[model samples]
Target: MDEAARRHNEKMKRIKAARDRMMQDKTEEKGLIIVHTGAGKGKSSSGFGMIMRCIAHRMPCAVVQFIKGTWQTGERQLLEEKFADECRFFVSGEGFTWETQDRDRDIAAARHGWELAKAQIRDPAIRFVLLDEINIALRYDYLDIEEVVDVLLTEKPPMTHVCLTGRNAKQELIEAADLVTEMSLIKHPFRDGIKAQQGVEF
Candidate 1:
């Protein structure tokens, strides 16, 4: 064997040994609070991907959209068409806050969405719950952040993995999450005069 190939093989062996050792003491298994936030896209998209993972495992899952309107999306369509038996989906927002322009209505919608989210979270049969765009509601003060965080952190079923996805997630929720991912926006086509097109934004 060449000297470079031999050195590479030895390097991989050492890395694998170190990784195995690092994994030895990580034996605990439980539900996780996952947060996806920041200025970039894909927060809700990532949450939906996790829901697909749940479906692959034959686990019951629920999706509650707190601020997304009734527009159609590919993920929502696939979930409703093929995975109806394993996933429960809910759309609880009329549109964006600016589009609604009514504080009372927005608050009421957010609260109603929170109620549905809590039901799914409290259901022992459900292994995963996606509260999509809930942080946007919280950011606008449309829902009570304390109540939402309390239920998510304490009242959710022990084995249920709950994911909160949106931009500008509250600090309290960030502190409570077991895994937190912030999608940083380095560049976006929207700034380049490109509009959101089918199969891309929706």
Candidate 2:
């Protein structure tokens, strides 16, 4: 081999050895509480990606949308059609908080969504549960954070993973989660007066 190629192979060998050692230490597998939160977009999109992963594995999954219920989404339609036997979907919000503009109504909707989520969390058959936009509901004080955390910590099935997605996830919830991903916004097209498109934003 050329000198450059030999050096490259040596570097990759060390990297592979380190990765193997790390993998050897990760011997346990169980349900994870995953949180996707930040000011940037794609939180719900990432949650849906997990649902797709569960569907690929033929594992039962459920989704409880706490906000953004103004219209049907492409992901919702596709998942319902393709994974009908493995997925349960619910949309409890009337619309965004600004659209609804009713605190009492928003609270009721959030509670309803939480009820659906709790049911899915407790179901052993459901290996994955996505609480879409739940962080926003919690941020608006529409749902009790303590109550949600209690159910996530105590009531969820041992082998069932749960994902909560939205902006402004509470510190308490972040602390309780096993994995957390925050999408930071450096730039977005919406700032340039661009409107949300059909498939891209929805």
Candidate 3:
């Protein structure tokens, strides 16, 4: 064998051995509070990906979309249509604040979505809950972050995984989360006057 190929094989063996050792004792399993946030795109997309994972595992899921407010999304369509037996979906927001142009209605919509989210978290039959765009609701002060965090941390069923997605996640929520992912925006097509494509962006 060539010297370079031999060295690469040895390096991969070492990496695999180290990874096996690190994973050996990770036996503890509990539902996780996962947060997806930051200025970049794919926050809700990531959360929906998790829902797909849960569906693959035959785990029941519930989704409450807070700010998109009934806007049609490909993920929403597929989950609701193909996986109707596996998931319950609710759209709470009328739309973004700027689009709706009504603070009272925005707040009401957020609160309504939050209530649906809480019900999902409390349902023992539901294995996963995604509060899509809830961070945006919190950012706009449409919902109380403290109360949201408290209920999420204390009241969710023991085996119910919960995911919150949006930009500007609350510090308290981040502190309480088991996993937090921040999507950093390096470049987006929209910056160059490209419109959002349906399959890619929605």
Q: What's the TM-score of every candidate structure?
A: 0.97, 0.97, 0.97
lDDT (tens digit, per residue) of candidate 2 on 168-188: 999999999999999999899
Task: Give lDDT per model, in order.
Answer: 0.90, 0.91, 0.90
> Candidate 1: where are CA atoms >4 Å away?
none
Write down the lDDT that model 2 would get.
Answer: 0.91
Q: Which stretches of candidate 2 lie over 4 Å from their true place?
A: none
What are the runs in model 3 whose C-alpha is more than 4 Å off? none
How good is model 2 by TM-score? Answer: 0.97
Instruction: Give residue 47's lDDT in candidate 3 (0 to 100).
Output: 89
Q: Which residue pairs show collisions in model 1?
A: none
Task: Report the C-alpha displacement of residue 124, candidate 1, in angstroms.
Answer: 0.1
lDDT of 1 at 149: 83
Q: What is the lDDT of residue 8 in candidate 2?
A: 100
Cα lDDT of model 3 overall? 0.90
